[model samples]
Target: MQKKREPVADSLAPQYPIESVDNALKLLLLLGEQPQIRLSEATRYLGVASSTAHRLLAMLAYRGFVRQDPVSKAYLPGPSLTGVAFAIFGRIDIARSAAPVMRSLSEQLRETVHVGMLDGASVRFVAAVEGPAAVRVASRLGRAMPAHCTSTGKVMLAQLPQPELRALLPREQLKRITSHSIGSRTELETELAGIRERGYATNREESEEGVASVAVPIPTRAPGLRLALNAAAPQNRLAASRYPAVAAALVAAAKEIGDQLG
Candidate 1:
């Protein structure tokens, strides 16, 4: 038997609250707890009339916060909601806690460092620190990029279970951001296997021209939390010969950040 899920607890009520707006916001928060919501479920959850729930959902759908599946008649997250979520998750509490460590890592490596989290098939850079070097890679905070094209994403993906990874990247033909980006899932899986064996991942002009990076997963204590630490620099500055040392440094820094988070 399945257990009934609990709704998120609310804080103190505002002095001038609107019922309609409050109901709509509750629906949005409900999405965070479940993959999809049926009209009946929303009605029951909100303890409101079916028609009222329908209207609220219709408005949310029109505004791109939710989209209803034609066949299933269930509401799922829309692009706008996803974008907003990614933006918020980029600056989540974990990112705040790891900022100083990430900054120190950038200063030590003399290269731009970033903390990225997986969001669907993309990686969202939550925090970044620019190196003091004059020609360093710039900060990528709040940017979402193709996961297969980045060391930060790849390192985290390599740690994900095969089923989850395949679900995130189901098709064989993957979208390429640059000429060097992996073009197929087969090739990406092969590289991921290597990343697993080496305990890290690397990108060499895969995400952008003349850019190179190394990343290791942050060992968070929280379950289902996937985050990585990466250091990026110019291809010449972050040469292949330096990968091992750079990767080692990133691994240590990632551990430090994780320990602090714990």
Candidate 2:
């Protein structure tokens, strides 16, 4: 018989699966894959007693791999955990993970689709798929756009704590990418409020002269990172009256991407 190699500390040797570590790793995967998870469900998923699950979660939380919601008692993926995930799963992997789903959504909606990640006060489009149409929103891959004017930027900004938002955006005269762009922090704060309630964000020719778009967040393995996928078209095609339906489509695509990641 061939000799088995000794597993190193950073090894992924499956032959030496340690029970406790395996269970905890599985739990971490679930946390990374979903937006929120409850203790009861976690226990059921792992076929463990509440005490056992609690111990695992408590250890993870202490390590900053998990965060428990104060009001709902649900668990959210923590910043430290996200850092680990991002380190292990590089940026290209994230774009690769969402590619097929982005294509599907673009075809379904007949509009240009983009996957972007927040970079300070801007959004960097990592991947894009164009739609089948004579006139459409142009591909924005490899581009960084102002955060306050794009749908992707708004959705990500809406989730930031007030202090963080202020730190990133500031209270000074905001850049005027277009006449329709949010002109001040006061207006942006009000707009972000509505975006939080609606679970999606929209841009009415805010970033460009005549582009309209809707976007939804795509929760990733990164804890502190914010990513969004958006569908965009000309203002006339993606009219104000069509925002509701467009938002729905974006949300649905985001959900599918989440499920795919899981």
lDDT agreement with native, every candidate:
0.85, 0.81
lDDT of 1: 0.85
> Candidate 1, TM-score vs. the true structure?
0.66
Q: Taking the tens digit of each residue's C-alpha lDDT, what string does model 1 give over 29-102?
A: 77755556889999988889999999999999999998777656788767788777556544558667888888
Q: Pick the candidate with the highest TM-score.
A: 2
RMSD of each: 7.6, 8.3
Off by over 4 Å in 2: 1-86, 89-92
Say what the RMSD of model 2 is.
Answer: 8.3
Instruction: Output candidate 1 Cα RMSD.
Output: 7.6
Best by lDDT: 1
Q: Where does candidate 2 have its weakest 10-residue lDDT segment? A: 1-10
Q: Model 2 shows how many backbone clashes?
A: 1
Error of 1 at 229 (Å): 0.2
Predicted candidate 2 versus true structure: per-residue lDDT over 110-194, tens digit per residue = 9999988887799999879988898989999999989998999999989876656776776667887989999898999999999
